[model samples]
Target: MGKSHVLVIPFPAQGHVIPMMELSQRLIEQGVKVTFVNTEVIHNKIVTSNWINKDGVDDDLRHMVSIPDGLDPCEDRNDIVKLAKSISQNMPGKFEELIESVDKEDDTKITCIIADFNMAWAIRVAKKKGIKPAAFWSASVITLASVLSVEKLIDDGIINEKGMVLKDEMIRLSDSMLPMKPTNMFWVCFEDPALSEVAFQIVLAAKQASELTEWVLCNSTTELEAATFSMYPQLSPIGPLLASNRLADQTGHFWKEDTTCLAWLDQQPACSVIYIAFGSFTLFNQNQFEELAFGLELSNKPFLWVVRPGMTKETATIFPDGYMERIGSRGKIVSWAPQQKVLAHPSVACFVSHCGWNSTLEGVTNGLPFLCWPYFSDQFQDETYICDIWKTGLGLNKDERGIITREEIKSKIEVLFNNGMFRANALDIKEKVASSIAKGGCSHSNFNKFFEWIHEKDS
Candidate 1:
């Protein structure tokens, strides 16, 4: 057999790329030759972003190849709806051509494709090119069960073809899984036409993956989602594909990490810090930003916050007068922090997060209790799992203004630390997460099985 060469593609978002990137590095560690592919814009951002640390990986391994996303240079790829549309409409042909060129030039021919589920068209394209295709569902498997059930949902009149929930209710994906708010079906669950288009696109992609693929690679563990895994036997859970477990801290981030946070964390007493980060894409309005700042101040807790560029909506100012000075050395804020380092820090006790799956798993991986403030898409679902089913997190409720107030934030912190109940729960879940990734653990065994599938005889 020729070398096991795989073409890896992600959906071009920080969240999507990081897990796929982790998977790529893991494959490389297992002696698979990998061609890592990303959209041209995302690749440039990773190269230019201040948060990346590139010295750790080999130059050959670090080499990234890009394909056009079919958007004008001036287009804002940050706009999720337009970006999703562009990727769906554009990347398949470009990727197909890249594969052909690679097959001719490289000694090892392309044997398979491991693509992010959002880019389902790549699987269809792989079929045409006669390459094996596997889809990576980047979010929780419970979320996948919800997405893969789209057709059943439509048949039951629960959701429309456009991905809209026809009735306002909770959606129970499986008997053992936590039920979800119908409105939080996904990012596309919104009634807005633009968001609806993206939702439908996701549904279509899910359909393609369920119908066309033989094995679905998920970034979750069977222990974490046992019921979901049992419900869909085709999904092989090989994750919490955390950088820590894989021995790679270079999971792709679009911003430079502030190493200073580590030094800052080292000074604080054990479990005394509250680390706050609202992932890459969540933007805040001026009022909401000020409210959060005041909320953090009111809590009077030692905190490390990531306030990225363009995070606030044309607010002209993100913090109120004297806020930073009031907190003084008690709080640390940067555009980005090496998250895994901070989460793993002994001083970091509670997490104020956007409930993105990566952040959720990071919290789980590090055993940090959560204060869930979800931002968009499937975040609500992950939060539900954390706070509702898993009981490792506390969801912060928005006020009458439909905002998370300073008082609300302050109160939640006090409540979370009250007798340290949530921390105890988090530690229990942490044991499961650790065991899932340890040698001969569930994820380790599942990953070995996945590699076997990759090396299986097609005939």
Candidate 2:
């Protein structure tokens, strides 16, 4: 048999794209020819960032393929609803063209199209071509399982076009298998039907996923989602795909990651600094910003925070009067840091994260406990596993006005830092993750099974 040619596409966010790249690399190591596809805009950034060198891969065997994303590079990233709608409408034709053009030049036919579960357009195109289509959901299995429960949510009035029911609300889901908070399920609170419509498209895509292939792959591990698997047995759990020794040589993100923070970490005491990043996509308003500032100051712990410009208010520059001076020599806040490197540092003790799947896996792989402040999407679900199931993280509460108080923030950080049981639990998950990524571990076996399923599909 010739090389099994695979085209891997992921949602063009930093979190989603990174794992797919890792998976692509792993497939290539298994003698599969890989083509990693990103939107043209993101691809341009990848090139300009000088992250992936021309000599990064063999002259053959692997390449980057970028097609039109139907939006200009300067378009608004905040208009996620619009962006998602446009991509859903337009991506199929471009995908078909890309696959056809590649297949025309090489006899190794496109054996599989592994795509982000959000990118539903690929499935129809793959079906048309008589090729295997595998959907890779970067979120947790429980989140996907919850998403599959959307109709039930609508029926129970747990979710509506305006917003979901609040955590303390009377509405209940059909099963406690995917217990959820209001903001956790989907982002439809803007009172605009457009957001809900966009959300519907995402759900449609996920619901259709169960129909598209038997090989629905999630970037999660069985160790993490034993409960989710017990609830929904059909889904595949092959993830927490962190360093795994293979990604050590791979390129970083499309933007240059600041390494000075690592130098700062090197100077701190062992397990001393709190690593805080809400991820690249999340932003806060002014009130929330001020609270976090005072909270971190009051915690009296060494911390490193990545605060992007415009991440808070129009007056984002004015964090607080003399706040930085108060935390002098203890806190280092920058725009963006090399996250995986920072988390891996021994000086980094805990992670205050949004619980994005990629960051969660990175946190676990580095043996860092968490202060889980989830923002949107499946982050709350991931946080549920981290805090509730895995006993490795803690959650923050918002007031009636949606503000997380400085007092609450300070308390949670202190608890997570001082609690011995939290540390022990985090280390246990860390060791489990280590073994899973080790040779002939559970993830490795699942990966082999993934391939065997694909080959069996081919045969």
Candidate 3:
């Protein structure tokens, strides 16, 4: 007779938090009492960013809570290995305590726990508390399949127990997925051996935790990866979880977005502006930054680029000499952007992106072609999906020096523009994604089933 209560937790990264927050909003709309949890540092950023507007008196069923990530305020939260280790060690006990406190303060009891697959320890804690557990994979289903295939990789001797690649070869998990080099495995992609080992252990833990989950939800669609979904029937495709789908402003940004960019986009000619943005955590050396700048200049096309703080290794992002004067009015650069709106704008042409899953989905849903410049980890795999599988994008080739030259950037932009097929493919994928979330579509059916399951009295 009481409203079902759910506790939602996401890995404390921008990409992970946004999708999980969107899912929480969906649950709220369904009349569920939801508690959304974030790390203390991330929560502070969200609050200061003013996206949530907690002061507005509206939804009493929804709440946002934060727990310490076990790091001091001055610590570098950007270091993935350190942050991962700290959360694994410190957050579990803190999360359990939060649950106990919430029960004492609220009338509804938490009936289920939905956690990011990366933070599978929450699933363990949920089980220990006799709460139903579900795992949400924010990235592509192919990536999830890869993470769950750690044991098979070890059995095949492709990787060692510590997640080191023993053999340098291309392998495919199934005929449905793309062939990838052994070295590119998510855990093995780290440059540091110690970091790779820790990442591997985390992956192993997630896979083990998955076995205990009652439901496995993925922010993907069978339309995009039908073959992979067929291979792993457990993954339910309920995503492209964007706020735009529900006609709401996106939340969970670590940086405040610049709305002026939207006005600048409106002034540009239709399909004339190049939109470039790398997701949070991408860093560039001074050389690459300069080259990217000159490349955008050489393209001679109107462009909007997001140069987030700390994007470059140098203390400050330095443009080429007289760069601002030379490209006056032709270029617009902002520290952070309203990406979903930018992608949806008619003036935007194509995306020059780092190929993070969130950016990939945004571009795909908006029917924009891509010029892929993947940096590391799962991004490389995402590029393969964009360029090879979907044929909606082209990859930028780095020179022998491992820097993408200005000429290469200019050339790829020209190629992407000249080719109509890429846009056609992009539009085609966009239509499929639209249909998937529409009534009677696969994602719609899956979401309805999930909703029913969550409301089940026995669950």
Candidate 4:
């Protein structure tokens, strides 16, 4: 019997990479060999960080490999979309070559690929050979359904020459319980002829995604999105992948993780602190930043905020004068903190979030309630599920220009904190999330099924 090997690739970003890493870890635990591919630039960053925290990842069972992303490393993150567009034309041959090199010395066949939804090129590569490829959507199932529905939207002319342009009025989708104007699927959903050309290139990539032997795999659990799962049985829901009580994946980041915040949380009362983060990529303008700062202060609640360096162009000027001092004793701020640890802390009561899926799962698993502020992509959909279907979170309604004010922030926080009803509901859902990931649970069973499929047929 030869070794069972799988290649795992994620869309090049922080939130996307983390879940793929978790899934890869699980595959390794089940006795499969794994190769995780990141761009050279991202790979270098991980390597430097590896020296700082040797315990973060198992260097033996899993290996990190790199390929040229076909983009200049000098470009900033905001320009990543344009850079990614360029890669579609260039990376296929490079990736095929890399696969050849891996196959040369080993008896293991490149049996299957589990790639991010954005990495649709892998489907073509897998099909060109005899291997299998499956797209993994590390988000709520509603989001995957929404992205798939974009083709339906295009056929309906809901999108204009601008590619799903929104008028000042909110446009509602039939799948959505609430009204939300359709916008960019971050950049791939645009309709501008030039951008649509890029978008069409992506659709060219996405449409081929279903050609894989296995179908889409989402990180959400079935109980959370029963309607979505019922509609697309092929889109398997195997997630909320946390240990009991959100206690797992404490391996920390590629970099040395600081635990000062955990010590700080110990002194706070149980479920009394509001934890605020905007996932990895969402950014705020100065006005919105000050508004959030003032709103948190005005809410008169103890709060912990993760304000990353890339969060704003004018981050230094965004905070109000004496703002840190005004909330001095009650506030804790860090450029970055061990997020999973902070979310699981006893004092972390509520979350003010950008509604990214990873954070959504973490919050639900921990039983913390939410104040949802969605930015882009499927975040709005995640927000809808949190506030509407899940009954665990509240959404922020922005104006025509998408600006949310301090008063709105303060009012929502007050409503969330004072409403014993909301907290109870959030906690109730939390228990369900925990149960689904437990032994003999739905997600657990689904994972085992996936493992067996890979081993018996593909591997």
lDDT of 4 by residue, 1-459 (tens): 556788888877777777787888788888888888877766666666553133333555576787988877777645655767767877778889888987896567688888788788877787887777878887777656645666666666665543444343444445523455555354433334465556545654675676555757778887787777777778777786543333345432444455687888999999889999887677778878887888889888898998877688663645788887789879998877778888878898899998988888888888888999887777877888888888888988777767887788889988887888878888898888778878888888888888887887643
- Better structure of 2 and 3 per TM-score: 3
lDDT of 4: 0.74
lDDT (10s digit) by residue, model 1, range 1-459: 545788999988889999888888888787777888888888777767632344322444433678999899999876768877787778878898899998898887888898888888888888888889888889988878877788788898888877766888776777777787877877455647687777677767766765787878889987677888988888888889888744448578887778898898889999889899999888899989988888888887898999988898884645898787899999999988889988998999999999999999999888888999988778998888888777887998887889988889899898887757788888888898788878899788888877777767532
Best-matching candidate per TM-score: 3
Number of the predicted model whose lDDT against the real structure is largest: 3
Cα lDDT, model 4, residue 45: 63
Candidate 1 lDDT (Cα, 0 to 1): 0.82
Question: Residue 199, candidate 2: how far off, in angstroms?
Answer: 1.4
Give the lDDT of residue 267 in candidate 2.
91
Number of the candidate with higher TM-score, 3 or 4: 3
User: What lDDT is reached at residue 162 by model 4?
Assistant: 38
Rate residue 248 of model 2 by lDDT.
Answer: 51
Total colliding residue pairs, candidate 1 = 5
Where's the lowest-lDDT run of ten residues in candidate 1?
50-59
Clashing pairs in 4: 163-191
> CA lDDT of each candidate?
0.82, 0.78, 0.90, 0.74
